[model samples]
Target: MKKKTIIEIFIFLLLLVFGLHSDAQEDHSKMNMGQASNKDEPRVTVDVPQDQQSKIGLKTTKAKKEKTLHTIRTVGTVTADQTKEAHVHTKINGWIEEIYADYVGKAVKKGQPLFDLYSPDLVSTQEEYISAKEQKSAGSDIAKVALERLKLWGVSQKETDRLVKTRKAKRSLSFDSPVDGFIVNKTAIRGMYINPEMELYHIADLSRIWIVVTLYESDIATISVGDDAELRLPYDLNKTFKGKISYIYPEIETETRTAKARIEIENKDQKLKPGMFVNVEVKKDLGEAVVIPDDSVIDTGTRRIVFVKTSQSRFEPREIKVGPRVGNSFIVLSGLKDQEEVVSSAHFLIDAESKLQAALRKGESQPAGHQGHGK
Candidate 1:
């Protein structure tokens, strides 16, 4: 019985040893797994691989050092300059017995005879003048006054001189234009009877021209007298005429929501006339401003941005507020720094790349079925 008891104790001790050994094996296996996990840890880095980098082309521009605001654009019309505008009308209306100017739009000089008329009243005045001249040496002051009256009624100096020498009446009344202008209206025909005071013709002088310009109410504050303006005819856009603001209408036109500005331009050759439609551009000066090359900007609906290259193949887009232009460049009101490297020429490519990236990200956010792949 003593020997069996010892043997049972021995068996119990062996079983306990086996259990402890199994536990130790499990501990060693767990330690080895932890070590393997540590060995598999990835390295930390901030750079993207060359294949994953943005492949868009790029160009750069240095910001211009000037401070400018914005540009104003308006369209206007051309009008005859008031100074050169003329209205020619005849005071004495008579038959156009002999027409010197017979057509509309004919050019005439100042004091040029337009027509000749045979009038009984004119003939009677001339007869009185001839009798006055014959009696001038007979010591009558009334006769001398009648001769002066005939000279005042458009009888030419040469005609009066010939009448004084020949003592005979010259029997025709002459109508003369008082200004150098184009014949705008002609109401009289040859052999037509006329009244004492009637407008037989109309004339317009085309020495200088005007442009009727309209400026929006928002832009009216920027315009003032003597500001430079430009004109372009529709048929000849390449031809530009330069002028200055002469008048600014105090009242605003309600229907158009604009104010009228008058621009005076010289038209010595009569190329511009009344009722000419033209495109007018008011040239505003942006004295000095800080500007950027126009191409450097990328406009998102919500923000205007510019891409700044921080490192090779790396760019960051920044929001910016913009101002007016100083020629080919835009004034930077904010969100830009001088001397920074900006993608000027190929901004469109970079923008397109950004859009693709955004689209990809959006696709990843959607459900699998919504990604356009079959479920």
Candidate 2:
């Protein structure tokens, strides 16, 4: 009889433990449902007091659909245009006898003597031509061939004509500049041996120069060849150089994900020097888009919020995606519609007021026992 009594007490304790656990689980489920319901409910709207509106200078403006010119600003470096550059090289193995345009930055006109080269092969070829000229009965074909050989070695027509008329092979052959430009480079020494593989001088015309601008991938699509651009020097803000896009590099820089654009500007005064930094502005007309004042949008770094005027007094915070900024306005990409009015001024005060109101309302609506449930 004592054993049966003990068993009955043991079964009663087990039932009591399970019943307490069931009650705790039921309460927990109700708390979760309440928290989820609160999350889905829309935030309460805040009404800006009419008396305080004028004190804070609250202002509103309607979003309008209009064409906006978006300007892309970047920095670029000045460079010499490759089309106006010339590389002087020797065609034969020889020694440099003399250099007329010997200094860098020296100006040279077209057909101006640049250097003189002494080559044994050139002297031997000249002798062959002169010998063929003296013996005309030996067939003019030999002389014609030798003259062509001289021309191939960069012997000018004037030099060859003089050689044939004088009947003498000059010790050295003189070379002249092919174009009018400044000598940008000079590497040939008076007695240094030169070969076809060596470059003697580099000449470039500075009347026209190129500006290479680096642009991010996102900005590349807005620019194209023939587009007009404006350049300004940082220290000298009074003057502006205008130019057009001559080319866009097809390859992108792997590390920076940026591309290069070439702009040709006339440098009549020779003020723009190579390697100098200049600011560039590329303006493009984007078709009509929904736009609002720049002050209307509040950027929280993570998300962009704008206080939209729902009614005369009611203001609601809305999230929006914004495109490029033009002048003092921003192009709205989404979450805002045309003809809608937004709080352009004093919106930050309204944002603060709205958050406070929401916090207060949430505390009152939540159940008493669920203090830390939602959090």
Candidate 3:
């Protein structure tokens, strides 16, 4: 009976210990569940006193729908306008006797004498015209044919009349410039034999010029003819010339993987010279978009953050998706709305406080997957 009593007491003691262990485990599991539930609910609010705000120059601006211009900047080169370019070629084979516009870079005006050429064929045609006139058969078909031949050869009617009045064919005929421009190229020389195949002079009017810029395949779609652009010379930054996109080449350059865009600008002052490098800005109107001051947003490489004012002295950090930036603002694509206010100046000070508060909250929160053990 004594051994039975001892065994029964021992079994009761074991049951008591096991019951306490299970109760401790249940309590520990409940505590862990409570902590885990709170881990994901980290706090993210910051309060700045009035004095602190004033000290940091913290300022806010209300976001609103505003018309903005998206600019694409690129480098380009100035070139002569091809349509205004003139290539001087001889209509008949001749020998250059005199060169008035003798050298490259010389400015020439319309109807200005460029050079004098002597061609036997031209002299012969003039003599025939004079003979037709002397016969008083100038109105006859033969005389008309002679006059037409001289005209077809680029002989002016004045020169033909001079031949008729003098009854003598001049050895050389003077040729005048057809346009007012600078002589970009000149191949005609005194006493040099010339033919129609030779281009004697290349004149280009510099009053209007073209700036050809290269655009990547991605940027080409946003550009079109008649889009406004601004051009600035590398040497001159203060002055900007207004221009328009006049043409876009259909073919893409294979080596550079870019397409060419032509911008026409008036340079009546002749300040812009061909072959000079220039900076081009093509502004595209994005219409109405949600915009905030440029200084309002903080760009962390991984994401963009902006401190948004929730109430007086209270701010919240918001991650936003942003589009192209305009002059002094950014196009907010998401995470913001019109009429909302955001910190615009000295927001770095507010940002630091907000991030610190968030970090502390995260540290205070218990780990989600942690399991507590019972003593």
What RMSD does each model have against the real structure? 21.4, 13.4, 15.1
lDDT of all predictions: 0.63, 0.79, 0.77
Off by over 4 Å in 3: 1-64, 291-375
Tens-digit lDDT string for candidate 1 (1-375): 578546545543433333311122222222211221232211111112234333323456766666554455667766555564455444444556888888989999877878877767667766776665566577356556666765666555556666667867655756677778888788767888877466677776777777787778877766689988778888998998888899898999889898888888888777787887888777666666567887788665545677676665455556678865545677777877777777786565444444333333445559877776774
Please list all clashing residue pairs in model 3, or write none if there are none: none
Cα lDDT of model 3 by residue, 111-218, tens digit: 888988899998887777677767785445666787788777766656767765687888888888888999999988999999999999999999999999988877
**lDDT-based ranking:** 2, 3, 1
For candidate 3, what is the lDDT?
0.77
In model 2, the runs with Cα more than 4 Å from the true position are 1-44, 52-58, 137-139, 254-257, 300-303, 346-375
Best by lDDT: 2
What C-alpha lDDT, on a 0 to 100 scale, does residue 315 get in candidate 1? 54
Q: After superposition, how far is residue 210 of candidate 3 from its true place, in Å?
A: 1.2
